[model samples]
Target: MGLDAFVYCRCWQDGLTPPAPVGPVGFDEEGYLSLVVSGGGYTETDAAFDGWTASACPHELMEQASEHLSNWTGHRLFQQALGAAGWSHFPALQAELPSANGGRMPAEAAVRVLDELDYFEQQAVIDDEVVLVDEATEAVALRYVAAYEGVLMLGPGYRAGVDPEGFFILDPDSDPPATLFRSARFRQRVLPSGQVQFSDEKKSVQIAMSPVGDKGTPPEWLRLEKQHQAPAEFGYIVEPLRRLCRAAVATGNPVMWC
Candidate 1:
């Protein structure tokens, strides 16, 4: 996920000492170079470039740079990668609920989305629940969340299955369903009978991949920021909060939302 190269600050078009590569540069499908940099840390833009009078850099610049890099490549590597990884464009299952926005989403339209996904992937039952898998999962999931405004779910007893079409959609209602994808886009499909099914030309076995790998626990400092609200009073701890913020900024991943 990290890039194999680096670029210096002196080459930043401004006459200033550049900051070191804070993280590895990652390649999108188009091969554009990208790396995370400390926005608040000293950079070429900081006056004096880290001298006694240097001003702290702003964190927003890192975001700006990331956006720039995405276009710089002009290649959809990020998107391609996700698709290659078999991610969904949005979570595929929803609970039966009224459309709060008062807009009705026809079931046929939802089925069409599934139909398109069918040609690209496979479906299988993992731990006794059905799910979809394919090369496009990662790309699909990434864009799906961003485009559809969705969240990832985790837990036991979640069923994974092919969403009627060849695409993957987690059916939470199935016995032993491992996860359920909830999104506004799928809200209209939630019917009072809770019966949802689509047609697919093919079905096959699937393998699910978790971004969080099977591994040891992260350091306490890393954990603090990664799971900010988990323990509840994360912000009240000044030193930890400062350290986490500094760490995020330093790594080009400042917790702006947090």
Candidate 2:
């Protein structure tokens, strides 16, 4: 089985845009000859969707009627509520959230976090530790540990929607502690069962993570793992990706956890 996807590209831009596709994350549009480098594998089609989104596109366009007219007060409240609802998704890092981040959160809270990004000012940084803060509430939403070379795929549920509306990216003050990047070292050992594992003694934990949207989305990277197992292999890569596509459509939500 294999994955099929369209890559978006934009012309006339320089450098990696904020939230650059350093890994398998998806983009919202597709074009050819992008001015910026898109992280995912690309096809020969003269199209790419990996770049900084423009105001003209529906994905980046903000509704003027959104309740966040003045500052990010309204949106901030929403983000906090959402974070609370999704708290269970982030493990080992939950307690570290409130003080280091914002505070302890419940899995089902109504607090919406960063619902409208326009109210918040944004900046770009490379290979640095950045903090995600809700400007209105002064809450630290999340932290990103980046590599000077590129980004690593972020955790699931960091992005939980099809519109790519609720995601935020933050760089850390320094490289993430050793435990974060530890997983990459073991990637070289692809086991016979196709399952991979990382060992603390053999790997450093300092990893770079980027929040990516749902799978099967148009512009994100769709990795085709087992090309020869499509029709007959029930548990093959093709069926799994197809299942992801169907799930995305049925839910009307991006497979945000991918």
Top of the candidates by TM-score: 1
- lDDT of each residue in 79-140, candidate 1, tens digit only: 22224334454232121111121222223333433432332233311111112222222112
Give the per-residue lDDT of model 2 (tens digit) for 102-173. 122222221121111111112211122233333333333333322112222334322111111112222343
Worst 10 residues of 1 by lDDT: 219-228
Models 1 onward score TM values of 0.19, 0.16
Displacement of the residue 247 alpha carbon in candidate 2, Å: 29
**Considering summed lDDT, which 10 consecutive residues are worst modelled in model 2?**
62-71
RMSD, one per candidate, in order: 21.2, 23.3
Deviating ranges (above 4 Å) for candidate 2: 1-118, 122-186, 199-258
